[model samples]
Target: MSTTIEVEQATGPDLTHRLRDAIQNAEFAPHQRLIEADLSERFGASRASVRTALLNLAGEGLVERLPNRGARVRAITVGEAIEIVEVRLGLESLVARKAAENLTTKDAAVLRELRGRIESAANEGSLVEYSRVNQELDERIREIGAHATATQLLERLRAQSARHQFRLAFVPGRAATSAPEHVAIIDAILARDADAAEEATRRHLAGIIAMLRAMD
Candidate 1:
């Protein structure tokens, strides 16, 4: 579920962030019209603020502005999603390597706990839970890696491709297939094996690409 921003308290940037998250989380359907008046009322912001927020989202490629027709969520094609994941593959592999190199004892403990939760969610056939934990694992890896530039790039890429990912998570047996791959990533980091971590990251993302191709 997406976090709800309290009305009357959200600034322009806060509204933009909240709306971005809503779009990414599928709360707002792809291509759904975003009327300024509707959004202003919904977010309890002024029409001017809503317009500005929409403009910001448009720049991020998450919203499309129509001439005289206002705005709507952008719907990414499967091909586009695959391309985004391809870009992520390189950056994420680098992050995995750096994470393995920088893994401290405390990081290992946190990763282990996240790994356990991922496995449990997969085993229970809980797609929602699995997706949540999988994202947490990625965030933890990024934090451990400490790559600011890559992290910033990934944040946008992930948001852009989030809807496709949400669909993929519902594919039968996907969670089961991805669970071990995620575990391999965590295990390599725990062992401080940078090479293995990078390889594992590559393999995992490669699988996602394959699935995306099959989806196409």
Candidate 2:
């Protein structure tokens, strides 16, 4: 699926959400030019609204505007992907450690449920479910972490490298492997072991690096 999404009706808020969702879902391919007129008609919106949404994504580093080529999904080279994921490793390690300190029993329970759901989806080989779970877990963990700076940076890096994430998830067995890796991170958090949590998170990202390397 092209990660670019055109909604049925593009209200201002609806358009922004649709565009982000489409990008995150890999509805449009990386660097695929998003035709303004086509998108406007596809989402039953005015050309202005589609343009605005694209403009917003462009600001977020998820899309780029070219002089004549129009707006296209931001493409990540292998080096860029590695650099982004490296930054992510540091940010997420902070998240895991802080989340362990801050998460209440109820918060941990919620995370547990989410992980279970992720595992179920992975076992069933549902790529969409896995993708949703992956994002949800990251967001939920950040929420639990309760750190504004970390959350903001993590979201920024995530948006910047979303294309790579999409391709990685689409690989066979990758989604399934990601479930257990998530568990490892969550487990350390629930145990309130900050060093262990950080270490596990590092290992988790390292696993992704390994996966990417295997793909080469």
TM-score of each: 0.90, 0.82
The models' CA-based lDDT, in order, is: 0.92, 0.82
- lDDT, candidate 2, equals 0.82
Worst 10 contiguous positions by lDDT, candidate 1 = 1-10
The digit string of per-residue lDDT tens for model 1 on 78-178 reads 99999999999999999999999999999999999999999999999989999999989999999999999999889889889999988999999999899
Residue-level lDDT tens digits of model 2 in 68-122: 8899988767677777888899999998999999979899898889879888889
The count of backbone overlaps in candidate 2 is 7
lDDT of residue 178 for candidate 1: 92
Which residue pairs clash in candidate 1?
Answer: none
**Residue 25, model 2: Cα distance from true site in angstroms:** 1.1
User: For model 1, what is the error of residue 49's alpha carbon versus the real structure, in angstroms, after optimal superposition?
Assistant: 3.6
Off by over 4 Å in 2: 1-14, 41-49
